[model samples]
Target: MGLHQGPDPYDRQLCQGSLQRPGEDIHPPRPRGSGDRLRHPRRERGSVTLAVVRVRGIINVKNDIRDTLTMLGLGRVNHCVLIDETPQYMGMVRKVRDYVTYGPIDAETAALLLKERGRLEGRKPLDESIIKEMGEFKSFDDMGKAIAEGQLNWS
Candidate 1:
């Protein structure tokens, strides 16, 4: 006794590399006009406008940062492109310029400044209570005479 099933027709067709699918273009193609290719046609006899800002950086090697800027719609290095200047775009460019031009602070200078700050904060003298408990004595002579001449006693 055996229980067996034959191969599915769809699977057989796929295995034989004869699988077919429907065409993406279902409608009949229409003839394109002169302006049909453009999504936004350019205006005729109007003023052309552009905004340009200087970008400075060492962009020769390690261009991941540059690539990221381009991905966000900024043009290539050393070349200018017309872009829509919105507040958001302005902010993005400002940040990129800051990063490229002004690099990180040096570690030595940072450490020196930190050490100087600690010294300045920690060099305060002893408080007034300790000074007063020393009996307003300004010199070792005052302390010694008071003890030896019996003017002051500690018994």
Candidate 2:
């Protein structure tokens, strides 16, 4: 064969520059700036409450995911936080989905989490007296309801 007459070094028949096989239909390139971006269901969330848990370790993780986790207050493994179902929070959760787990949290579960794991300054567990002192909600359950309804801030 001549210098450039043999089988092409990169076979277009075998590898059509994509994963599709020869017989499969290859989609055409999408037009630019068409505003047809893919949308996720979670991105259209409302003001509901969500529980995000960090299930994986930090080793070998990307810096962006780690920063998102830190912004969501999941600095350690098994650490969880209650966040509102807004677009920004949803985006952060989606960005770290591979290293975390998240879902809607009910008022009962929020109350339980507050009673068991919620801490105040100096590492004090949340209690009714503190609630009275704070002059916000009557009890842990009330506070939990406020939090679950996206009426209260975590910080």
Highest lDDT model number: 2
Candidate 1 matches the true fold with a TM-score of 0.23
User: Which window of ten consecutive residues has the lowest lDDT sum in model 2?
Assistant: 34-43
- Winning candidate number (TM-score): 2
User: TM-score for all predictions?
Assistant: 0.23, 0.68
Clashes of 1: 0
Candidate 1 regions exceeding 4 Å error are 1-50, 57-68, 72-75, 98-155
lDDT of each: 0.41, 0.83
Q: Compared with the true structure, what per-residue lDDT tens digits does model 1 show for residues 1-155?
A: 45657666666666778454445345655668744355334422111112333355535634765664665444544433323334454455565664332212233432232233212235644333433476765443443333333343211
Clash pairs for candidate 2:
none
